[model samples]
Each structure stands twice: as C-alpha cells, then as structure tokens.
Target: MHAVLKLSKYLKPYKHFAVLAPILMILEVAMDLVQPTIMQKIIDDGIVMNNTLYIVGMFIVMIACAIIGWLGGAGCNFFSSKAAVNFAADIRADLYETITYFSNSNKDKFTLGKLITNLTNDVEMLQRALNMLLKVFVRGPFMFIGAVLVVFFTARDLFPILFFVVPVLIICLYVFIKLSITLFRKVQEAIDGVNTRVQENLSGIRVIKAFNRMRHQVKQFTGVNEELTKRNMTADQVIAALMPITQFVVNIGIVLALMLGVVKVEAGANEIGVIVAFINYLMMIMNGLMSSSNVLIQIARAIPSAERVVVVLEEQPDITNAENPVKKEILGDVNFEHVSFSYNKQVEPVLKDISFEAKAGSTVGIIGMTGSGKSTLIKLLARLMDVDEGTIYIDGFPIQQYDIETLRNAMAFAPQKATLFSTTIEENLKYGKSDATKEEIKEALVASNAIEFVEKLDKKEQHELTQGATNLSGGQKQRLAMSRALIRKPKILVLDDTTSAVDSITEKMIQKNMKELKGSTKFIVSSKISSIQHANLILVLEDGRIVAKGTHEELLKTSEHYREIVATQVEKGGILHE
Candidate 1:
C-alpha cells in the first residue's frame, strides 16, 4: 500500500483531474442525501397537511436534485477515466525505458515471458485500481458520513444503532483485505510461472517438434495451467464468504432500527415521515459500505502488481556508462589482457586468463573443443558482459570507456543462433546500418552469398519476414543474418559459427568476400578449420584457457586439442561447409 502511494507522484500533474472527479461524485452523493429530506417535507408538510401547492413545489425540487446528480456523476466518470489511462501511458513509457537499461544478467534472471506479463497484464491490473479509486474513493466514505449527518438532523433518536453497525462492517472488511492481499501475490507468481512455460514452448517449438516431445510439452504446460487455475480459485475463495457476512450485518442493523423507531414514534418523539427517512439513510450507509468493500478488494489486487512494476522500474543496471568515458577512433585493433569472467559467482570461469590481439585489416580465427569459451570472448568485446577479473580494449580505449551505443557502432557481433524480427526484409537489414542504399544492400547480400535466394523472393528486399523468420528455411535465415553483419561494415566483424548451416560453397563465398572487403577486421570462431584457415592469427582455446596462438598451420604443431578438432570436425568438411 505504501508502494502504491509512492508511485502516485507521477500522477501529481494529473491531480487536478483527480481532485475534480471526486468532488463531482460527492455532489451526486450530496443530491442523494438531500432527496429523501425533500420527500419527507412533501409527505408531512404538503400531502398530509392538505397543502397541494407545497407538494408540487417539493416534487419540483427533488427533480432538480436528480439532474444535478446525473451531471455530476457523468463528469466524475469522464475525468477519472481520463486520468487513469494517461497515467498508465506514462507508467508504461517509464517501464520500457527501465527495460532498456537492464543488464544481461537481469534479463536472464527474469525471462522474456515474465517480463511481457509484467509489462502488459500487471500494468493493466494497476490501471484498473487507479480508475476505481479516483472515481469512487471519495464518494463511498462521504456518502456514509453524510448519511449519518442527515439522520442526526432528521431523527437523532434512532441513529445510535449505526455506531454499533458501522464498526462491525469496518472490521469485517479490514480482515478480508489482509487475507486477500496475500493470495493475490501468490496468484501473480503463478501467472509468471505460466508465462515462462508458454514462452519456452513457443520459442523452442521447432526443437520440441524435432525431438518429438509434443506430449511431454503439453503435460508440462498443463501442470502450469492447472496451478494458475488453482491460484485464481484460492483468491476467489477468500471473497466467497464476504458478501453473506456483510448482508447478515446489514439485516441485523435494519431490524434493530425498525424496532427502536416504533417506540420513538409512539412516544411522539418522531413522526412516521421521519422514520421513513431514517430507513432510507440506513440503506444509503450500507450502499456506501459495499462500495468501500469493492475499493479495498481492488487495492489488495493492485498492491502485488504495482510492486512488481516498481521492481523493474527501480532496478539499476549492473553495467552502465561511466561519467566522462573516453572517446576513441573507430580502430579495428583489439586486445584482451588476462581477462577472466563467469556468469555465476560460485562457478568456474567461462573464460580464464584469455589474452590476444588482432591488428587492423587482419583476421583472427578462434578454434577449440566445445565449451572452450570462444563465443564468450567476443561477447565481452561487445560489452554484453563485464570481465570480472581483467580488461579488454579497442584501439587502446577500454571497452567500458565508451558509451554502449557508441561502442557497438564500431563493431558487429552476430551470435551463433539466428534471430530475426517480424518485419520487412529491408527493415531487418536496416537495423545493422540504418541508412543502407540499394547497391550497398546488394553488395552485402552478394558478399554473404545471400543475393541469389533473396532475388528469388516475391518482393525482394520488400518481402516481409514472418515471426522469427519462420516462413524462411534455416540456411536462408543464416544468409539473411550474415548479410546483416556484412552490411554494417563495422571496424570489427565477429561471426560466432554463423555459417554452420550454410553449404560449403556458400561458406567459401562468404570468406572470399571478407577478404575482398579489406580494412574491416574479421574474428571467426568455428570448430571447422577451413572457416578460419586464411587468418593472419589463430587462437586455440580449451576449457576457458588459450591453448595455442599462431597461424592455422602453427596451431597444428603446438596444440594437440586443435589437431584433434581439425582431424574430426574439419577433415570431413574440406569445402568449408558442415
């Protein structure tokens, strides 16, 4: 609850709307209170007193109050809803900015699925609470207190029954709130779990189908679905007893008020018109109490959700640009000085004591056994993660010394896995370099050996790439991704086994183009020796440590592990395709 109030600071500029909305709603409540008093006047002072003119006058007054109430209620609804939606837009914008700053560690900590849920569903829950509270928060309590005041002025003798009745109502609602908030938090966690499962299934649907694990996947998803259902039921269970309990309290109060009213009216302390008004005020108080109960229920649901959004918004990234970071020329020269890093604090390092350099206009091929930290090395060069132990530099400037956006422009690091957005083919390529021209796009596609197939597409560069490029074949996707890297023409190009799916002929063509496109440095990591055979330097890594560093031929003599990898994975693929 404290967390929610703190977040409301963003709503301060919109507070005028917030204030105006409730005041309008109070006018409606005020009309409700005044109407019954006018009816009492019509009955006692007009109809029963045989004054025809007074009856007409009182009836006209009641109609005017109804018009004011209608207009006030409409105005209240208009402003409150407007404030809620605009506030949600502001919150969503802030949340997206926060997401952009999240470290890779934090990104992996909360998977993409859970983040989507937080951004969409959790935000919606908080928005609903805001709308309800702004619209009804004031009127509910004001109506309750105002009813009591009207009752005191109209018939003070029977009103003491309310003191006992209202306290009991408040206690019941307070306990319900305490119990429901706990269950709502659990429900949100269950939703997160379900989101994770669905996201995994969708992203890896190809793998699941290839492995023939559809039933196994279905069983896993059902387990999460069942748990989510159970959690929703648990939240519903807490409120199941609430309405009956509230009704019982209201009924008891009504019977007591009637019994006491008869004694007072018989003693001439009150008239029947006054008793009638008393009954109406008592019901008005109960209506107000019920509305208050609903408001509390929304608050309970919103607390857990609002807190989740704030967690992401308030998070500070593990890596951020330092103040006054050094600006460096776009030099392709690269160096690593005894760098060591681990994704996990307690585990063995992913890359240990790794050091190497590839001067401008040179090629460095990285080869090793699986889990040899080849890909991890380039990831650090891109500032995807920090080197926990040592340092990395580009043209004598530490990787951390440049802002993230500025540094990335000088280098292109395409991962082993192929990822493409659901957009036009030209749009996806443009992400690599925003202002690429048609001739440049053709040159890059030709360099990556992708031009042949792309020219066959219905719309060529204008073709739409479906979700994850599912409509395209694997080799085609690789070609498109490679073309993106080529088009960037960065100071350094790092390809992490990106040609693994392409044919030997295509791989050879890509390597040939890299040589022709001189000046841009290339760092190729592959188990296949042919991919990096033309390198000026070769670094053989094994178990996070560098085993050998030299030309391709030099590594065959100095490194036994490099020799074995060449004998097994490379010997079968002389054409550079595997």
Candidate 2:
C-alpha cells in the first residue's frame, strides 16, 4: 500500500486532471442525492394535494438535475482517464531508463521476463487502480454520507436500519478484501512464471528445434500456463463471491425497511411520501457500498503490482559515475595491479592477483584454455565488472577516476559473441561512430575482411539484417561485429576471439589490416597460437594465473607450456610459422 502511495508523485504532472476528476465526481454525487428529496416533494405535496402544476414543475427540475449529473459524471471519466494514462506513460518511460543504466551485476538480479512484466503488466494495474480511485473513491463516500445525513434528518425512525446493514456490509468487505489480497499476490507470481517460461522458449526456439525437444518445451509452457490460469481463477472467485454477499445483505435491509414503513404509516407517524424517499436513500447507500467494494478489489490487485514497480523504480544502479568524475581523454596505458575477481564470493576467483601492463600503442595477445578467465580479464579492463581486489590503471590513473562513459568511449570491445541489431548494415556500422562517413565505413569493412561479401550483396551497406544477424553466416556476423568496432578507431581495441568463425587465411588478412591503426593499443584474446605469434607481447594463462608472458619467440625458447602449445598447433597444421 505504501508502494502504491509512492507512485502518486507521478500524478503531479497531471495534478490538474487529478484534481478536477474527483471534484466533478463529488458534484455528480451531490446531484444524485438531490433526487430523493425532489421525489419526496412530488409525492407528498403535488400528488397528495392533487396539484398537477406543482408536480409538473418539480418533474422539470428533476430533468435538469439529471442533465447536470450526467455532465458531471462524463467530465469525471474524461479527466480521470487523461491523468491515469499520462501517469502510466511517465512511469513506463522512467522504468526503461532505469533498466538501461543497470550494471551487469544489477541485471543479474532480475530476469528478462520479470523485468518485462514489471514494465507492462504491473504498471498497467496501477493505472487502472488510479482511474477507479478518482471516480469511485470520491463518489462512494460522498454518496454514502450524503444519503445517511438526508435519511437521518427527514426520516429519523428509519435511520436505525442503516446501523444494522452498514456493519454487516463492512464486515463482509473486510473479510473479502483480506482474502483477495493474498490470492492476488499469488496470481501475480504465477503470471511472472508464465512470462519467464514463454521468454525462455522463444529465445531458445532454435536450440529446442536442434535438439528435437519441441514437445518437451510445449509441456513446460503448458505447466506454467495452467498454473497462471488456476491462480487467476482462485483470486477472482473470492472477489466474485463478494457481490452476491453484499446484494443479500442489502435485500434483507430492503425487506426490513418495507415492514417498518407499513407499521409507521398505519400508526400515522410517517407519510407515505417520506417512506418512499427513505427507500430511495437506502438504495443509494447500497450503491455507494458496492462502489467501494469494486474499488477495494482493484486495490487488492494493485498493491502487489505497485510493490513490483517500486522495486524497479527504487533500484539504484550498482555502477554510477563518481560525483566528481574525471571526464578526460584516455591514452590507454593499461595496468592491472594484483586484480582479482569472482562472479560469486562463495566460488573460486576467476582471476587471482593478476598483475600486468600494456603500454600505449602495443599489441598484447592472450591465449588460454576454456574457462581460463581470458574474457573475464578483458571485461574488467572495460569496467563491465569491477575488481573485487586491487586497482586497474589507465594513463597512470585509477580507472575509477574517469567518467564511465568517457572511459568506455576510449575503447572499442568486440566480444566473442557477435551482437547485431535488426537494421541496415550501414546503420549497424554507424553505431560505433554515429557520424562516420561512407569512406570510413568501407575502410572498417575492408579491414575486418567483410568488404568482399558485403560488396557482393545486392544492397551492399543498405542491406537489412534480420534480428541477431541471423540472416548472415556466423563468420559474416563476426566480421561485421569487428567492423563495427574498427570503425571507431578507438584508442584501445579489445577483440575477444572475434575471428574464430573466419577461415585461417581470412583471419590472417584481417590481422594484417589491423596494423593500419598503429597508434591504438590492442588486446587480442584467442585460442589459436598463430593469431598471437606476431604480437609484441603474448600472455599464456592457466588456472586463472598468467603462467607465462613474453614475445612468441622468447616464450618458445624459455617456457615449456608455450613450446608445447606451439608444437601441438604446428603438428595439427593450424599454425603458419614465420
């Protein structure tokens, strides 16, 4: 409930609409309350006296009141809709912006499916609740209190009927609302489960097909879908029962009112017109209670949703720019002094006390077995994940001293997995350097050995790639990804096994073209010895430690591990010794 209240700040921009909606709804309620008194007058004064003119005059007044009430209700609906819709839109936009700033570690805390649900489903629930609150919340209490006061003053004997009816309805509302809230929370969790299952299946549809497990995936989806359906039915059943119970209580009250009215009329203590007006006010009171019940049901659903949205809204990104950050150009003189990191503290460190240096404009190659932290090492250098221990320096200053964007902008990182958007090839290249000219794009394509195939395409750079670049071959995707990085002509370039999909000859050609960026520092992480043999410095890693570091010829002479790696690759005809 507190979480829901916190979101009210989003309504500040729409305060005019928010304010007008309830005010108009109150006016409508006032108009509705006036009708019972007018009816009492038409019956007691006009009908009892047999005055047709008086009855006609009061009838015309009733018609005017109805028109004003209708206008008020319509205005309330219009204003409430505007305020709720804009409030939701602003919240949705802020949620997206917050997600974009989430660090890798922060992203790990939330699944893709759960985040989607928070942004769409949860926010929508709050929107609906706010809309109902503006209209029903204002109308219900005003109508209830107004009816009660009118009945008490004009028909004091009949007012005691409300004492019995109101308490019974209040008890039922409290019980139903409590039961529904717990069930609604479960329903929301079940929805999250369904979304997660669907997201996983869609993202991995290819893998499922390749493994011939389509039936298995279908079974899993069905289980979650059934769970969601069951939870929804359970929550709705509780709320559905509320309407019948409320109607039963009101019906009993109506019967009692009729019996008491007959007794009073026979005793000549009450006029028939007064009895008729009392019944009308009683119905109005019941209508007000029903409106309250409807709003409570919405609140039960919205409470859970508001909490979920607040979690995202209140989540502070683990990575943020320093208050007084240095936003300066980076020269890419890199140093890792006793750096160590682990994804989980309970697990063994992936990189342990790793100390190394790469001078500006140097090419350093890293070769290691699978899971030897080659990729993890470079991720630290880019500050995707901060080190658990020690500091990483760039240009003789700690990396944290620089603004995150400025530091990241100084380097271009082409990861092992090629990620490309569903856009034209030229637009994808422009992501690296938004203002890049056609000639610069062509140069990057040529350097990455992607020019030959891209030139052969009918539309060349204008050709549209499918999502994840699925339309292109693996090697082609890798080439385009490398080209995207190379287009930046960054001060530091880190290529993590970027050419593994290309042939050895093509890889060699790409490596040759890389020399054109002579002033940039480069770190190439690869499994192939041939890829790094010409590097100014080569690092051989094992068991999360740099066991050997030297030029290829120097390492081959002095390090047994380096010699064995070269020997194995040479025998397999995977390396071309220069």
- Judging by TM-score against the true structure, name the best candidate: 1
Question: lDDT at 143 for candidate 1?
Answer: 88
Q: Per-prediction TM-score, please? A: 0.96, 0.94
lDDT of 1 by residue, 271-366 (tens): 777877888888888888878878888889989989988888877888889798766657788889999999898999999999998898899999
RMSD of each: 2.0, 2.1
Lowest-lDDT window of 10 residues in candidate 2?
569-578
lDDT of 2 at 277: 93
lDDT of every model, 2 decimals: 0.86, 0.91
Among these predictions, the greatest lDDT belongs to: 2
Q: Model 2 compared with the native: what TM-score?
A: 0.94
Residue 296, model 2, lDDT: 86
Off by over 4 Å in 1: 50-53, 570-573, 576-578
lDDT, candidate 2, equals 0.91
